[model samples]
Target: MHRSKGIVIGFWVVTALLCLQMGFTAYAQLSMPEVAEAIAQLGFPHYFRKELAWAKLLGVVLLLAPVPARLKEWAYAGFAYTLVSALIAHLAMGHGPESWIYAVVTGVLWGLSYFFWRRLQAPSVGLRPATA
Candidate 1:
């Protein structure tokens, strides 16, 4: 029971961290001039920034709300994909290896959150088999 509680707490902590990162990212994407300039420098259309910001906000909500499990799973998958793509984009833009840190850190957070979430859904490790 203690272990299960630990896992639940760990899951929420990691999920909160991921949500915080995504929330800030979405806000920056929507409102920051620097973010717009960076996206534009990457050859993306000006409208893509707003679109991605909205998508990220929605994804964060899906992860946090009492939504269906399948939807939550998609949110996790979407975040994973977004981070990986960001890493690739940075590399493609000729950014040095150091520029990958933000994406890498966020990716790890996402991974841990997803891992704990899956573990929480499994049968408790402390449970014992019933005897006849």
Candidate 2:
């Protein structure tokens, strides 16, 4: 069966939202004092903030752009890894479960976006015409 236009639009919408979220996160990490303080409290080096911000920004671009399929796959994987690691880090630091809610939500969004992306990539299967 042919893929529905609605599905494609939905995929794009989710991907766009994910991009916006990541962009905002990267910006906050790079410039927000509170975020820097939290990072320090977590025992991460000051320079890690900048590195993570840049990496997240790059991931957002890779997800949104019409890049190679492999690159897009890597972007999805990267976001998944980032979110999971964030949750783990929060838990490791003895932060309350509530502290990891953002990571959980983002992880769900990433999974949905990746599912739709893979669905869109799949070729439609239909019966072929019979030959004489």
Candidate 3:
């Protein structure tokens, strides 16, 4: 079955958004004192800035790659998990609402993308196609 145009657009949008978020998070690690303070407060001193940068970059690549459908689904699942984790981190660390904005958007975008993907899947042979 062909992918829906909406899903394709959503996939690109999510990829770009993830990249933008990665850039902002990476930059915050250097430019914002709050990032370091938050990290410290979270008690993960060894989890340096580079780790998050690399993870986000890798996640973006995985989501954008021309992998098998199953692999793509797995990538989306991973990305969703990461978004939720980031949201929790921000809330637990007392970061502003802005810090969790990406997480919220990512979650919504992923949900929409996944919904379209599922809707586009071919129906089983045992079932009759829906009549218009």
Candidate 4:
């Protein structure tokens, strides 16, 4: 089935935004001492900051590359899990909205990206909200 132009555009835009946010955060975590201190303050080990940053970079690559559908799905799921976990960590640490708001905004971007992705996949036998 041919994909709809609108859906294709929507997928790219939202996915780009999501990837950008993740990628920027990963960069910050890797390069900024402040980020490391913040992560430590949140009760996460120092190593976790590196691990999470690398994982985010990997997930961003997977989402942007023309990988298998299963891999793409896994990347999306990983991002969703990361966002939720971040929110929980912030809340558990009693951080104010400024600290946790990143997760909330990223989650919205993630949702839009996933939604458009699903619509792009709606071309199979049972899918309906897909392309033209």
Candidate 5:
């Protein structure tokens, strides 16, 4: 398979994984009072969880859409931001090994999304003149 195709495939795989993770996180937030209690136990701001959940849902939509490159770029940016914040929150709270594992997974997913976003932004063969 072509390298671009491979990148796209990787993008989708990462996207799916993120969607699963974030979707479940959102579900837990929405349905599981225990999750809220847990978040409260961490002593972090509440907005982080709510906003992260929404951002994840929106990011998934952008990845799935056939929109312009700029929007896709923004989508990846959102993913990166969310994941990084999650990593930070986990670290600051002194969670055990699972925290590091989650950070690594989020980093890998962000890297994959970043790779594809950059690829999409590259100038196409038959496209318009390059911007200066």
Candidate 6:
């Protein structure tokens, strides 16, 4: 039981950090002129930023709300894809580590959140201690 509690704590903490990163980036996409310029420079249409921001907001809602497991799974997959795409785009554009470092760090956070979430879902899986 104590282990389960610890896992729960770890899950929420990591998930919260992931959500904060996504939320901040989404806000940046929506309001930051530099972000707009960067995307446009990358050949994205002007409307992409707003559309991505709304999608991220919806993803955040699904992640935080007590929605169905299927919805949460979709949110997780969306975030994973978003992070990977951002990293790839930054690299492909010849941007240095400064540009893509946050995505790498957040990717780790996302991995942790997914790990703990799966553990929580099947707490009786192989992680459980054998009783005396």
- Which candidate leads in TM-score? 4
| Model 5, TM vs. native | 0.74
TM-score of every model?
Answer: 0.89, 0.90, 0.64, 0.91, 0.74, 0.89
Determine which window of 10 residues in candidate 6 has minimal summed lDDT: 120-129
The best candidate by lDDT is: 4
Error of 4 at 82 (Å): 0.7
Per candidate, the number of residue pairs that clash is 0, 0, 0, 0, 0, 0
Positional deviation of residue 70's Cα in model 2 after best superposition, in angstroms: 0.5
How do the residues 40-113 of candidate 2 rate in per-residue lDDT, one tens digit apiece?
A: 88888999989989999999999889899899998898888889888999999889978888888888789889
Instruction: Score each candidate by Cα lDDT.
Output: 0.89, 0.88, 0.68, 0.93, 0.71, 0.89
Please tell me which model should have the higher TM-score, number 1 or number 5.
1
C-alpha-based local distance difference test score of model 4: 0.93
Q: Where does candidate 6 stray beyond 4 Å?
A: 1-3, 123-132
Ranking by TM-score: 4, 2, 1, 6, 5, 3
lDDT for predicted candidate 1 compared with the true structure? 0.89
By the lDDT metric, which is better: model 3 or model 5? 5
The residue pairs that clash in candidate 4, if any, are none
- RMSD after CA superposition, every candidate: 2.0, 1.9, 4.6, 4.2, 4.3, 3.3
Query: Which regions of candidate 4 deviate over 4 angstroms?
Result: 124-132
**lDDT of each residue in 25-108, candidate 3, tens digit only:** 667776678777766776666466557656666665765676677876776676677778878888888888887887788677
Please say which candidate is ahead in TM-score: 2 or 4.
4
For model 6 the TM-score comes to 0.89
Candidate 6 structure quality by residue, lDDT tens digits, 8-119: 8999999999899999989999999999999887777999989988888898899889999899999999989988988998998999999999989999998999999878
